[model samples]
Target chain A: MNISEERAQAWRADLRSSMKAKERTEIPRVHMPELDAEYRSHSRLEEVNLGLSAEQAMLEAKRCLDCANPTCMEGCPVGIDIPRFVKNIERGEFLEAAKALKETSALPAVCGRVCPQEKQCEERCMHLKMKKESVAIGHLERFAADYERESGSISVPTVAPANNIKIAAVGSGPAGLAFAGDMAKLGYEVVVFEALHEIGGVLKYGIPEFRLPNDIVDVEIQNLQSMGVHFVTNCVVGKTISIKDLEDDGFKGIFVASGAGLPRFMNIKGENLVGVMSSNEYLTRVNLMDAANPESDTPVFKGKKVAIIGGGNTAMDSVRTARRLGAERALIVYRRSEVEMPARLEEVKHAKEEGIEFWTLHNPIEYIGNEQGRVTHMLLQVMELGEPDASGRRSPIEIPGKTELIEIDEVVVSVGVSPNPLIPQSVEGLEVTKWGTVVVNNDTMQSAVPIIFAGGDIVRGGATVILAMGDGRRAAKAMDEWINKKS
Target chain B: MNKIVSKEYFSANVIKFEVEAPLIAKARKAGHFVMVKVGLKGERIPLTIADADLQKGTITLVVQKMGVSSSKLCALEAGDFITDMVGPLGKATHIENFGTVVCACGGVGTAPMMPIVAALKKAGNRVITVIAARTKDLIILEEQMRINSDEVIVMTDDGSYGNKGLVTNGVESVINREKVDLCVTIGPAIMMKFVSQLTKKYEVPTLASLNTIMVDGTGMCGACRVSVGGKTKFVCVDGPEFDAHLVDFDEMLMRLGGYRDIEREENELYKEALSSK
Candidate 1:
C-alpha cells in the first residue's frame, strides 16, 4: 500500500477508536457569527456570515453522532462521505476534512456557504431526531475548507495516468468546473468555455459577494486549474465555437452546462418600462460589472424604493443588493406566503435582519410607468393560500377585489429563469423539452447526440449549485466509462 | 485575444479596425455583430461586423468615439490586442432578390449596411444604397458601398456630400423614382424611425437593425430587449433586425439612453486618466 494509504488507514482506525457518542452528544451546536445587521446593511457590502473559529468548528463537529448508518450522505446530492469529514473535523484534522470533501465536491467553500442545508444534509442529521438543533454541518464544512485554504498548502486531488482523451465543457459554472475537475483527475485534457469575460458562471454573476464572495469562487476555480483544467473565457460555445467545431477540434466528449440565464417576466403591463428589469440583469450588473459604482460604464439605476418580485433565493439576493445600493425601502413582493418561499431559511433570516421587508401573499399585476417610461408604481394583488398544487406547496390564489397600488421607483422581476437556447438550438440532433431545457438520459446525463452530455441549468432548468455539481460528477463517471468502452 | 491587423481613420472620432478573428470571419453574415471589449474594465460594446476577409482570417469593426469604451477601442492601433472579442451574434439580415432594394444608413450605420448591400446585390437585386452623415468628412465606407451596390447615393445633413438631405429624403427619392420592394434601414433609432415612416407611405416592407443596451451579446441578459410587434424580444438572440413598422422606436430610444449619464461620467474619468498619463 502507498504511504498516503497507510496514513489514511491509521487516521480511520484512530477515529473508529474514539466513539464516545454520549459525551459527543452532550456538546451543543455552534452558532455562526455574523456582521451586525444595522451596520452591515448600511455600510459596505461585506461577508455577513463570519466563519467559525478553529475551536468553535471542532466543538460543533463533536455534535455529529456519527451514526452507524450516516443518512446525511444520502441527503447530499454529491453523496459526500458526511461521517468521515465530520469525524475528521471532530479530531481537529481540518485539512483532512477538506480533503475528504474534495474527494466528491469541487467547491466545498461555495457549497458550504450557499447550500440549503435545512432541506438537505442537516435535515437528515441524527441530532435532529434527538429533538435538538442539528449539527452545523454547513458551518463546519466551510471552516475546514477555509482552514485548508488559509494553511497555504492546498491539496490537489490525486490524478491518474494520462488517457490521451480530450473533453470540452461549456460554461465555467459549478457544473462545468466539477466535470472538468473529475475529467482532469482521470487524466483527460479538459477545456471549459465561458460565454462571459469572467469565469464562474452564475456563481460570479448571480450570487452576490456578501453571501458568496468572488474570491472564494476564484479559489475553487484555481484548484480546478491546478488539476489541469484549461479555461477559455469570452467564448460562447454555440456562437463563438459550435458543437461541430469542438468535435472537429478533436474534443471527444462535450458537456454543456451553459446555464439557464434567460429570466422570465410576469408578462404584466409596463414590464418593459425603463426602471424594470430581471433579477439576472440586476445581479449581473451589480455583482459582475460593478454597476453599483456611480462611475461604472453600465451603472444600475439606484432607485429610492426598489421592489423585487418572487419568493426564491434570487429574490432575496436582489432585495438585499438593493438595500446595499441605498434603496430606502427594499421589499420582497412575493406571491406566496413565507412557508412556500423557495429561498433558504438562513437567507430569509439574514435578509430580514438587514431590514428587507417581506410583502408575502402579494403579487404585482401591473407596473405603472410615468411619462418618462420609468416605473413609478406597482399594482399588487393580495393573495391567499389554497389547495396544495402539483409541487405540493400550497398554491397562492389571488383575493378578488383586493388590489392595492404602491409607489416604487424600480422593480426587479425574479419569478424564474429559462434555459439558455443557444446550445440546444445549435446542435441539430439535440432533443429539447418544452421548457427549452436539453433532454438528457437521467442515469447518464447524456444528450441525444452520442458524444454530447449536458447537466446543470441546461438540463435541469434552474437548480441549486450542489445539484449541478452532482450532475457534473455523475456525467464525468458515465463519460469516462463510455469512452473506455468505445475505445 | 484577437489582434488588430489594421486601423483606418474615417473621421477624427471614427475609426475602422480589422481584427484577427478567423472563426467569426468565416461564420459572420451581413447583420451579425461581435461584442468587443477593449480593456479589463471596458464595457462589452456590440459592433457590427462591417466586413470580413476569410482568406486573411480577419473581421472589420467601425467604431465611433461616442463613449469611453468606443474611445478606448478607437485609440488602439494596428497590432494591438483586444482583451475579449466574442462574435457573430444576433440573427443575420435576411437577404433576397426583392427586385429593387433600398439600403439606407446614417453615420457608422453604413458599416453594417456594406455587407448587406453586397449580399443583396450579389443575390440579383438592384441595390440602391443611401449613406448619410452630418457632413462629407463624417461619411464612411462610400468606396466600399459604391463597389457593392449598383448605385451609391451619399446624403449629408449639412449638404457637404452628393445630396443635401436626410437619409429619408434619399430613400424617398429612390421610392418615388423606383418601386422599392424592400427597404433595409440601419442607423440611429431616430433616423430609422423617419425612414420607416417614409417607406410606410410607399407601402414598402422595411427591416431595421436595432442597437440596444446589452451586457452579454448572448441572450443571457435581457438588457438588449426591444419591443417588436407589441411583444418583447431579445435583440441579442431574436434579432438585431426587426420589422421597422412594428418596432416601438420611442421606447427603444428611451431604453438605449438608460446608460447615457453613466457613460458620460465614465468618459470624463477616461479623459482625466488620459490627461494624467
Candidate 2:
C-alpha cells in the first residue's frame, strides 16, 4: 500500500481506540446551556440558548460516524457536505469546517439558529437507525461558525473574476442574499434592492433580536458585501422601479425574493377592535421600528394581558414578546392541540418555561371592546379533534354551547401570510398561484418571463431560511447556465 | 433616496413639500397617495398626492404634524433626502364631466382637492370648491385651489378668517345654488361623514377619500382595511376613495385610534429629545 493510505489507516485506528476507551461514547448528545428559567421569564430580549462551548462541540463532533454514504447530506436543503464538515471539526480544523459550510450556505450562523435540524439532517443520522442519540450537528455548526467569527479571522469565500454582468435582486432576505452570493461567486455584478430602509428583509424586521441577533445577520451580509455584492436599501422593486425600468437600466436578469409580508386576519365579529393586530405588524413595529421603546415616534401597545392566536413559531414569539412587554398574563389561544402545533419543539419548550400559558383546542369567535373601543375580552369556542385532514393532522371542530370569554387587553393574530403581490401586479403576463405565490420552474426557479426569476416566500408562501437559500442556490446555477447560453 | 425640492410651512402644524420622484411623478393622479419614511426606524405614513409636476419630475405632499412620524417629516430641510417614498397608490378618483362638480375640502384637505378640481374642469365640468379649516392660519393650498376651480368659497370655525362656520354649511350653500351632479369631499373621516349626511339630504352623489393605518402601502398588509357596504376592502389596493354614503366611518375611527395613547407618549418623548438636543 502507499504511504498516505497507510497513514490514513493509522489515524483511523488511533481515533477509534481513543473513542472506545472513553465513557463519552455512551454519553447522549451534548446539552446546550440555557438561561435560567425564572430570570428569562421576566426578560424578553435575552437569548435563551447560550450556545455550546468548544469542549461540548468537540464531544458532539466526535460522535459523528463519518459514514461512507451520508444520508444527513440528503436531508439538508442545501445539500451541505455534512460528514466532511463534522470530520473537519473532529480533526481540529475549525476554520476549515466553517469554510466547508460557507460553500453551501450563505447564512451558516442563521441556519444554525433557526433551521429545523431535528427534522432534517439529525433525523437522517446513522445513529437514528441504531436507536441511539444522533450527533449534535446543528450545535457544532453554530460553534464552528461562531468560533471563526469571534476569532476575528473571518475569510470570505473565493469568487471568480468580474464578468461585468449586472443582476437585480429584490429584497435582501435570506433568499436574495443567497442568490446574490452565488451569482457574485460566478463573477456577476449583483445588486440587492430592499424596500425597507434596512437590509435583511424579514430576518431584520420580522424576527426578534433575542432569537437571531441582528449583529449575526449583519456579519453574514457583510461577508456577501465583501465578495462584491452591492446593496441598495429603501428601493421597492415594483414601485420604486418597475421591471421594465430595470430592463431599461441594462440589468441582464432579475431575481425576486420580496417575501410574504402580508398579514391575514379572521373576519369575525369585533375584529376591527383597536387592540387586534396581525403578528406581522406587531413584530415589525416592535423589532423593525423602535416601537417597543416609549421614546420612539411609533410606539406599540404594551398590553396588560395579551392573547396570541394560532399555533406556530410566530405565535410563540408573539406570546414571548408580550410577556417581555410586561403582560401580566400571556396566553396562546389555539384551535388545535399541542400535537398539531407547527412550531419547533425547542421554541415550544422555551415558551412553556417562560410561563406562557397554552389554551389548546380553543378558537376565538368574537371580541368584546370597552367604551374606549379597545379590546377587553375575546370569546372562544371550545374545539375537539376530528378526523385527519388533508395535511395528515386532525382538524379542529367547534364544540357547540361550550364557549368561554378570555379577558385580554391585546390580541396578536399569527394565522398565516400570503405572498406579497407587488411584482405580480406590476408586471404583465407573470403567472401566480391562487395563494399569490409566483409561479416558477421548480428546477430553475425561472418564472414565465425569461428575464425574471423568483425564490423564497414569494415562491413558497412561507418557508425556512435554509429552504429559501436552497432555492436561491438552484436559481443561481440555472441562471448561470441560461445566461451563458444566451451570451 | 428622493431629494426634497422645496418646503414651506403654512402653519405651526401644517407643512407642504415638493420632492423629486420621477416614477411617481409620471404616474400620480388625483386622489392618490404615497408612503413616506424619514429614516430606517421611521414609520410609513400615507400622504395624499397634493400635486404633481411631470416635466419637473416632482410630486407635492402636504403633511400635518399630528403624530411622531409627521413631526419628524416636518423637521426635514429642503435639500434633505427622504429615505423612502412609494407610489402614486390607490385608485385615482374617477373624474368625468359630470356637469357641475362640487369639491368640499376641510383644513389641509385643500391640497388633495387641487388635482381633482383641475381634472374635472379640464374634462369640461364647472368645478366649485368649499375650503374650510379651524382657523385662517391652518388653511392651505388657497391660491392653487383658486387657480384650478371655477369657483371657491372659504370658511373658518371661530371667524378667524372667512365666513364663520363648518365645511358642511358651505356644501349646503353650493348644493342649494348649483345643480350639483356629484360632490367629492376630502377631509377627516368625521367631517366626511357629516358632509355625506348633508349630500344625502340634497340627493348629491358624494365620494369620500379615506385615510387609515397602513404598513406596506401595498395590498399585502391588511392593516388599512375598511368596511364599505358591509364588505371588507383594503384601502391600499381596492379604494382609498369610496362612496361616502356606503362607508362605515365609526369602525374606521375606532381602528385608526388603535395606538393613540402609545403615539401620544411617543410624541412627548420625541419632543423632549428634540428639546434636549
Candidate 3:
C-alpha cells in the first residue's frame, strides 16, 4: 500500500481506539461554569455555554466515524465538507478544519455559532442508527472556527485578477455579505450599501449579543473587508438612490438583500398604547444602543412586568432581553404549543433554563391602559388546540368564557415581519406580491428587472441566517452566469 | 440617489425642489403625494407633488421646514441628493364637473391645493380659491392659484393681505352671495374641521386631504392610518385625500400627537446642534 494510505489507516485505528476508551471511561459530564457571582445576570446574554474543554473537544471529535460518504455534507445548506473537517479536528488540525469550512461558507464562525445543526447536519449523522449520541458536530465546528480566529490563522480565499464588472449589493446583512464575498472572489468589484449606521443588518440590530457575539460578527465583516469588498453605511438604496439611478451610476448589476425590517403587529384593540412596540424597535434599542445602560442617550423604557407575544426566535430574544432589563416577571405569551413553536430548539431550551415563563395557549385580546395612556395590563383569551391548519400545525381556537387579566407594563409584539416596500414602491413596474414581498424567480433569485436581483428575508418575509446565506450563494452563481452571458 | 435639478425658496421656511423621477413624474397627478427621506437616519416624510413635468422627467415638491425631519431635509443644498423618494402614492384626487368649486388653502396647504384647483377649472367648473395664512408672509401659491382659478381671494388673520379674517370668513362671504357646488380644503385639522362643519350646514360636497402619521407611504406599515365613516383606512395607500365630512378628525389629531415626545427630543437635539454651531 501507498505510504499515505498506510498513515491514514493508522490514524483511523487510533481514533477508533480513543473513542472506545471514551465510551468505557466513567468521567462525569463537565458542566459549564456559571457567571461571576458579582455580575447581576438573569438574562441568557451572559454566554452561559462556556464551550467544551480541549479534552472534551477531542473526545467529541473521536466519536465521528469519518464515514466514506458522509450525509452531513449533503444536509448542510452551504454543502460544507463535514466529514473532512471533522476528521481534521480529530487530528488536532483545527486551522485546517476552519480553512476547509471557509472554502464553502463565507461566515463559518457566525454560522457555526448560530446554525441549528440538530435539524440539519447532525440529524443525518450515521451514528444515530446505532442508538448512540451523534458526534458533537456543531460544537466542534464552532471550536474550529473560533480557534482559527483566535490563533490568527485565517486564510483569505484566492481571488482572480480584477474584472471590470461592478455590482451593487443593497443591505449589509448575511445574504449581502455572502453574495459580496463570492462575487469578490470572482474578481468583481462589489460595493455593499447599508441604510443604517451599522454594517450588519439584523446581525447588529435584531440579534442580541449573548447568542452571537458582536465581536464574532465584526470579525466576519473584517474578513470580508480584507477580501476587497467595500461597504458604505448610511446609504438607503431606494430612498437615497433609486435602482434606475444605480444603473446610471455605472453599476452593471444589483443584488438587494435589504431584509424584512418592517415589523408587524396584531391589529387588535389598544395596539397604539404608549408601551406597545414591535420587536424590531425593542431589539434595535437594546442591541444597537446600550439601552440597558442608565447613562445611554437612548434609554428604553424599563418595565417590571413584561410580556413578549410570539413563538419565534425573536420572541425568545425579546423575552430574555426583558429579563435582563430588570423585569420582575418576563413571560412569553404564545398561542401555540411547545412542540409547534417556530423558534430554534436551542433557544427555547436556553430560555426555559434561564427561568423565562411560558404562557402557552393564551392570546392577548386587548391592552388596558390607565388614564395617563400607559399600558397597565393585557386582557388575554385562553385558547385550545383544534384541527390542523394549512400549515399542518394545530390552530389555537379561542376558548369561550375563559379570560384572564395579566399585569404587564410593556408588550413587545414579535408576531411577524413584512418586506420593506421602499424599493418596490419607488421602482415602477417591479411586480410585488400582495404581502409586499419582491417577486423573484425562486431558482435564479432574479426579479422582474433583469438587472436587479433579490433574496433573503426581503423575498421570504422572514428566514434564518443559514437559509439567507444559501440564497446569497444561489444569487451569486446566477449573477455570475448573467454577467458572463451579457459579456 | 435621486438627483435634484433645481431648488427655489417659495417662502421664508418653504422651499421647492425639482427632482429627476421620471416614473413618478409620468404617473403623478394633482393631489398626489410622495414620501421622501433625506438621509439614512432621516424619517420618512410625505409631501404633496406640487407639479410634474413629464417631458423634463422631474417632479416638484414644496416643503415647509417644520419638524426635525423637514429641517434636516431643508438643510440640503441645491446639488445635494436625497436617500429615498417614493411616490405618487395615496389615491389621486377625483375631479369632475362640480358646477362651482371653492378651494381653500392655508400656508403650505396651498402647494397641495394648487393642482386640485387647476383640475377643477379644467373640468369646466368655475373655480374660486381662497389662499389664507396668519399673514401675507405665510401665504404661498397665490400666483399659481390665481392663474388656475377664475377668481382667487387672499386672506390673512392679521390684516396683512386682501381680507382681514380667517379663511372661513371669506368662504362664508362667498357662500352667502352664491350657491357653492363643492368645497375642497387643504390645511391643518382644525381648519379643515371647521370648513367641513360649515360646508355640512350648506350641504355642499367637501373633500379634505388628511396628512396623518405615515412611515412606509404604503399600506404595509399602517402607521398613517385614520378612521373614515366608521371604517379604518390607511392614508399612505387608501387616501391622503378623503371626504372631509366623513373623516374622524379627532382620532387623527390624537394619532398625530402620539410621537410628540420623540419629536420634542429630536427638536431639542437640533436646537442644541444649531446653538453649538
Candidate 4:
C-alpha cells in the first residue's frame, strides 16, 4: 500500500479541488478502520482500531475545511496546530504533518488512541457546530504519526545548546514524559525517575494493549531517549533518595508528575471477600502482572461469573479483559443509566458486541462469599438517576427494599482512584490538599517548594492523558522561565 | 533478568528461591527487600532478603503462597528466570553493640531474623532467638537460627515442638535472667504487638520489622505507608524495621488485612488448579 510521490501529488491536487470551504462542507465524515468485533472479543490482546490508510487520512484531512480561526486548536489541550498538520497531510506532505504535531504533542500516537477528541477537537470543528460531521482529527493524527514511525525516519526536534542545566522529572507517565520531552528540547540535562520496573507510568500499566499498545509507547519513549532524555527505572524520587537529596545533587528544577496510581475500593459489606478486588489490582495483575498464565508468579482468578462494577473506562477494560479470560457471564453493574456511563461510546459498543451484559440502575450492597471466603454472589440494590450533582453527573438514589442477587465469582471495583501520595507525604513543607493532591500554582505548576513543581494526577487528582500532558507542557514552560531567570 | 539457582518448597505454600543476583547479594543487608517481577508482564512484588551469599552472588527469598503475586512466585521452579529484581531496598537494621539481643521470630519472620542474628553474632553480641509457629511443620529457619544465635528457643501453639506456649514465655524468662539490651520481634502483627507490650512492661528497647503492602520496593508508591511515632512512614523507604513502642500496629494490622478477601479467593483458585495438575 505504498503511495508513490507522483501519484500522491496527483491525489493531493484532486483533494485540493474539494478543499474549498463550500466543497469541504459537502464531504462526509471519514470512517476509521476497526478490528472485527467478533474476532477481537475472543482475543486477549491487539489494538481495536486498525488505524487509517494513507488515502483515508488524505480524505479526512481534506474535510477539515481549513478554518481561518482554527477553533480546533483552542479545544486541543497541547494546542497542536490542527489545521497546519491536516492541511500538510492533504497536500501530500505526510512527514511534515508529523513534524508539525511533534512541535506541540509529546505523544501524538498515544493521544490519537486515548484522548476524548469528540468532546474536544472535533466538538470545536466548524462543521460540527453547524450540525454537520467534523473532520476525523484523531484518526489523521494517528495516521501521520504511524506513517512517520513506520517510514524509519523519526525527525528529532532541534535541541538547544546544553546550558549545563539539570532538571529531574519524577514518574514517567504522560505528564512527566511530556515535561521531560520539552525540558530535553530546551537542552537541559533531563532525567526521568520512575518507581516501577517499566517506564511509561500509566501508559504502560493502566491502559490495556488493545487501547494503546506498548510498542507505540516504546517509540515515543525512544524518541525522548534519543533527544538526550535519560530515564532511570526502578528509582523512586522520595524513598530511594529524598527530594532534598535531588536538590543537593545539583538538580536546578524538579517536576513531580507521579500520577494517580492508588486504587480505591467500595466500603461495602463482604467487600473483603476473596473474589472481590479493586479494578486497579485486577488490571495490574492481569494486564501488567502476566496473571493469565497459570505458571506465572501472579495468576489472576478466571471466574465463570465475573461482575465488573462502575461505568468508567477502567470498568469497561476490566469486563472486556474478564471476557478474554473466559468468563461465561461477564457483566457490568453500574449505578447510573447507560447515558451517564463515563466509558467511551466505542468501548461501550465494543463491550456490547462482545456479549457483556449491562445491569444499569444497580449498585452492589454486599458481596456474598462462601464459608471458605470466596465471593460467590453479589447482592445489588436497584437505583434510579436523580438530579445533576456537583460533578455535573446525575446522582443515583438507591430504592429501598429492592434487592437482587446474582451468582458471581469475581467483582472488579473500578469506582475511582486517588493521586499517589508519595511525593506530597515524603517531602517536608509541601502543601497538599485534604484529598492528598499536591497544591501548585495553576499557571506555573510550581509548588511551595520553589525548586519543585508538580502536575498530572498529582495535582489534578486524576485526569485524561491529554489533560495531564497539557499540564506537563505548561509546567515545562514555567519551569524553563523560572530556571532561566535564576541562572 | 535473573536465573533461579535453586528453589525448594518449605511447606505446601511456603517456598524458598535462591536467585543469581550478584549485585543485590553483595549489597543487600538485613531489613532490605527486593521487588521481583516474575516475568515481563509480572507485577512487582516486594520480597525481603531472607539470606544472601555474596561469594555465591545469590540472594534467597522465602515467599509464602499467600496472594496472586506470591502464588505465582511459588509456582516457579529451579532454572526459571525472573524478569526484574530491583533493590536491597528499605533501610538496613541499625546494628550495634546492644550488649544482649532478644530475637523473637514468628512464621516467615524467622527467615529475615536469621541474617540479623548472624550479623549480631559477628559483631560479638550475645543473641538469644525465639522461633514460633502454629505447629512443628510450620516452623522454618530453625537450623539457621541455631547456627546464628548464642542460644535458641522454640515455641509452638499445638505443642508439636519445644514449649507449648507463646514465644513471650521464652522472652520473659530470658529477659528476666539476662540484661537484654535490645529486643527485636519479627513476625505477624499480633505476635509483634504482644511482644511490644511484653517488652514495655520490662522497659526494654524493642524493634519490630514490618512487611507492609508495597508496589514499588522503591519509595515512589505510598502503598507501603505505616504510622511510625504518629507520622506516616513508608516501610519500603523509611523503615521496614521500626520502634515497636511508637509503631502503630493496629493500623498496620488493619491495612495488612485490606486485601485478604481477594487474596484468599485467588489462593483457593490457585490451590484447586495446582491440585488438579
Instruction: Assess each prediction's global lDDT (C-alpha) against the native.
Output: 0.89, 0.86, 0.80, 0.84
lDDT of 2 at A86: 77
Candidate 4, residues A1-487: lDDT per residue as tens digits?
Answer: 2222322455445655654677777878888788887788767778888998888888777787665577888899898988778978987799999998998899999998988898889889999777788888988999999999999999998889988898999999999999998998888999998877789987877788888888999999999999999998766676556788788889989999998755666667766566676777677666555567555455467888999999988899899989888898999999999999988887898899889999999999998877666789999999988999998989999999999999998888888878876677679889999888999999999999999999998999878899999999999999999987987
What order do candidates take by TM-score, descending? Answer: 1, 2, 4, 3
Give the Å shift of residue A260 in candidate 3. 2.4
Question: Which candidate gets the maximum TM-score versus the true structure?
Answer: 1
The residue pairs that clash in candidate 1, if any, are none
- DockQ values per model: 0.62, 0.54, 0.12, 0.20
Which candidate leads in DockQ?
1
lDDT tens readout by residue for model 3, B192-226: 88888888888888999988766545444455667
The worst-scoring run of ten residues by lDDT in candidate 1 chain A lies at: A1-10
Task: Give the range where candidate 2 chain B is weakest over 10 consecutive residues by summed lDDT.
Answer: B214-223
lDDT of 1 by residue, B189-258 (tens): 9999999888888899999999998888788779888888888999999999999999999999888877
lDDT of 3 by residue, A1-487 (tens): 4323533676655765665644523233233344442242455356645566667776567677776667776778777877667777778878878887887788888887778887889889877776665666788888888888889867888888899788999988988988999899999999998866578888887888877788889998999898899997645676546788789989998999988755777878877666777787678777865556533333366779999999999999898888878887889999978888999887887777666899999999999877656789999999999999999999999999899998999999999988876677777877789898889999889999999899898898898888888888889899999989998
lDDT per residue (tens digit) for residues A353-412 in model 2: 888999999999999999888999999999999999999999999989999998999999
Better of 3 and 4 by lDDT: 4
Spell out the clash pairs found in candidate 3. Answer: A239-B83, A239-B84, A240-B83, A240-B84, A241-B1
lDDT of 1 by residue, A1-487 (tens): 4323533676656765576777777787788999999988875458999999998987888777766678887899888888788878878888889999998899999999999988999999888887888888899889989999999879999988888888999999989998998999999999999988899999998999999999999999999998888999878878867899999999999999999867898788889988999999999888888777654566678888999999899999999999998999999998889999999999999999999999999999999887778889999999999999999999999999999999999999999999998888788988999999999999899999989999999999999999999999999999999999998
- Highest lDDT: give the candidate number: 1
Off by over 4 Å in 1: A1-19
Alpha-carbon DockQ of candidate 4 = 0.20
